[model samples]
Target: MTDLDAIPDDPSALRAALLAMRAELAAERALRRGLEDRNERLQHFIRQLQRMQFGRRSEALDPDQLNLALEDLEQAVAEADAEAEKADPPRREARARERRQNRGTLPGHLPRIEVVIEPPTTICPCCSGAMHIIGEDRSERLDVIPMRWQVIVTRRPKYGCRACGSAVVQAPAPPRLIEGGLPTERLVAHVLVAKYADHAPLYRQAQMLARQGIALDRSTLASWVGTAAAELKPLWRLLRDDLLGSAKLFVDETPAPVLDPGRGRTKTSWFWAIARDDRPWGGADPPAVVFTYAPGRGHAHAATLLKDFRGILQTDAYAAYKAVAGAAGDEAAAGSADGGVLLAHCWAHCRRRFYEVAQKRPAPIAHEALRRIAALYEIEAEIRGRPACERRAVRQARTKPLLDAMRPWLEQCRAQLSKKSPLGEAIGYPLNQWEGLTLFLDDGRIEIDSNVIERSMRPIALNRKNALFAGHDLGAENWAVLASLIETCKWHAVNPEAWLADVLARLVSGWPNRRLAELTPWAWKAEQDALHRAAA
Candidate 1:
């Protein structure tokens, strides 16, 4: 270290002093650079948080319904607090309190419990007269009893033939999902819904059961889930087959980690989501999604899963999908052969690449591209509910010209920007996948993006975030099976718990395989609604 006071005020003396402390100065500069880099990362993280909490969710810039709901709840809470303050004045608030007492009406369907409070004396205070009841103040309070366990005792008397003495008669036990297991169909369904739908892990669920004096081990719950998955797999298979049979399908994949016992860590697995939703294009087929778990994210797995298909496949620019397309041979590229799958890439994915670049830097080129793409979505919003033919004609007339103009603009920008840069990569994406990206121009039934299947992956993402990882590959497969049905039930706006309960009961009661289609979410919802109407 060189002291400034000891150094002379001459150029040569200062130069000599600087030379002596160059190593320390260099280290100080290096430390400053490191701190600056860390500061940049922390700032970037803060921007991400701001965007997530306040930024527009979709490319369309549609208003968030969740925010609207939150506003309504806040207004309700404010009003409640105001009411509570006004009610503090005992003399002036009696009438207002009386009006507010029964403001909320409980449903007539719920059973009521009554508690009568009589006067302390049957005489009036002013007069010494015995009085009959004139009026009564009745206040109803809703009550709930937590889940209680009960033992179901089935008494089946046995009788023998008295005269013949050769025959024996006994009532047989009813068919159950678990033949000898104590849980009923509803109980098994409850466990399934709790784990897959509610995102409750088995160990946590076991503790919850223990709180109710039902001391079941986590392994027991896991066994029940495995058995239920095996039983319910037929329905899942039927759903997948039905979805694949459709003419158009949206496909996407998300990572799922499976525990590796040998390595004492987790291995990366994949959950491939295949969906068929024609309502967006005015087709008559019901919307359905099916998820399949695989040991790896490879083209062979996708090819095998889609081997029986001859339809348009919508997906992102994953090389695996392209490999699958190539392996099917060049002839099947058009999807006209007996077994072919045509690729239709997602525009949302293309926009997302540039959106990230634009968020990070002020890229005018990316913004321009986004503006042009937004115009196409504006046209889509206008003609959404129209017939497929009408939609096709509109896209050809309006959207085609913008896309034609965008291609050359993208190419010209790519020539000027670095090929490895984010903007340049975004420009190159559409150029490489041009045919697939523009598939919507030719077909009216195909969507502009594979957003439907991506939307279906959110539940899996949330569940994985909560549970961290599945116990094993088989456990992940079971997760896929149960999650498929539960998510499908949500897609059809059916209560998952109710659907699972009804489906499990039906299976235990010997639901025929031929009528398996009737057990699907849409069909089951119709049946339940019909039965409710009949009962009403």
Candidate 2:
């Protein structure tokens, strides 16, 4: 080989060298662009995901509730084929089974009923005589209670003063739950309680009430709700103050339909809830739950609810909440639109959306996230009904630090992922929604998510689905009243029907104003405790 041959290169060789360099650089640039896009997307997705999942609903429920949601979602997914999006034959069979047992208020335990006679013998317990069977035994199950109509009669008597030769009627009775109205206070209470606390609607209630021969026209029933609600306006305000005044408050909003009178359009109203238990902050009161009706579900609604409220405000990612709070500092506006509110985010909700997507695709990244979330839930489950302060300690010790470690891992997953993809939905959703999701860490009283509000919303949802819309402002307000009271009762573990019937039955004219409060669930509960103590 000549030295000239090694040194000299043909034009072809030089051209090939140039081409290789260009191709190598091009590949490197392309790889760099892919990494950058992945990082950007992951960042955005995480921020958005962090906003809120189911908000207050998931956090407020007991572990069993989460289990129930998991069960429902599992059954829902199993029966459903994403591509076909239809139930398989087996799924259809399961659907029938579910429907048969679809009563509401999902009983915590199956009741054991004792009968005097054995089932095989259709004999009467009183006579022990063989009796012809009227029909087959029938059973209907529901997610909660199935209401039936109950009539309560109140009679105020007239007494004549014969000795004085004067005729005087016993004072006209104090206003009933429905003063001179169609439905009894108990009936109105039942409707409000069912619709708001249980999420059953008035139309369904009309049907339910009809079963018991309480021929309530939906309009007439609506009128009674309006009237009864109007009477309780003062009470609602008092309750609202009680809730907002608490140091720890959880807030959430769900859409409610209000009838548009002139256009007949169903306007969306906001059903906002604020709940807090004094167990953490104040010792005396049980958990106080309050529901407020707003014209719209904007920041304004939330602002009004939390105005002048100094405490922890737990909410999800509606953007409106932060904006409204942010605007509170701008002094240029009319005397602060609303006072400052400290907001805490929810974790359970953010995790849930990811969990759903993870269900569809269990990639390594998603699986890891699932494992982390499961750990948090396990902590919450262990102390199911624990006090707020203890819960805070457990979460602070367990959840806060777990989330701190998870952040870097989440960022890494985001970098390797595509933004518009399913993985993006799972990963990015929580990341984007991070601020609110993390807000809870700072406040001991604020929940991990707004599950309590969501639980509160379910009762309203059931009622809305069945009844459809509130007829008028007064009608909606009445809904706020009864729902607020009954839900509070449910929150504190009191039966609303029992309280309302007893309160309404005792509305005597001469009774002192303070005595009337005994009808309220809190007061009624106090009275019950007193009675129980006496018996004990």
lDDT of 1 by residue, 1-536 (tens): 85658878899988987886897889789868866865674465344334434555431111232222222222223223233333344622453355345334434444554544443454434444444433333443322222645444344433444444444344354555544455656667777787778887666777887675556656555655666676688899999999878888888899998654344345799999999888877888889889999999988888878877767889999988877666655555555466566899999999999899999999999999899989989998898878899999999999999999999988899999998988889989999999999999999998898888988999899888767776545567778999999999998999887788778878757799999999999999898889899999
Candidate 2 regions exceeding 4 Å error are 1-219, 261-264, 278-285, 328-340, 383-397, 433-435, 503-520
Please report, as a residue range, the 10-residue window in candidate 1 with the lowest summed lDDT.
Answer: 59-68
After superposing candidate 1 on the true structure, give the runs of residues whose Cα lies further than 4 Å from its correct spot.
Answer: 1-151, 158-170, 329-339
Residue-wise lDDT of candidate 2 within 1-536, one digit each (tens)? 53555542778886887798799999889868866865674454333223222334322333332222222122222212211112134643454356345422323233322212223333444444444423232232211133432223333333333344333333233433332333445555565565566665455566775665445545444444444454455556767876767766777777778654334245788778887754432356557678887888777777777765765667776777676556554532457544465567777666776777767765777778878988877776775566667777777888889989988888888888788787776677678877767765555555556777778778778767765665444346556667787788787678876665565446422245554545557777878999999999
Q: Compared to the true structure, candidate 1 yields what TM-score?
A: 0.70
Question: What is the lDDT of every predicted structure here?
Answer: 0.72, 0.58
Q: What's the TM-score of every candidate structure?
A: 0.70, 0.61
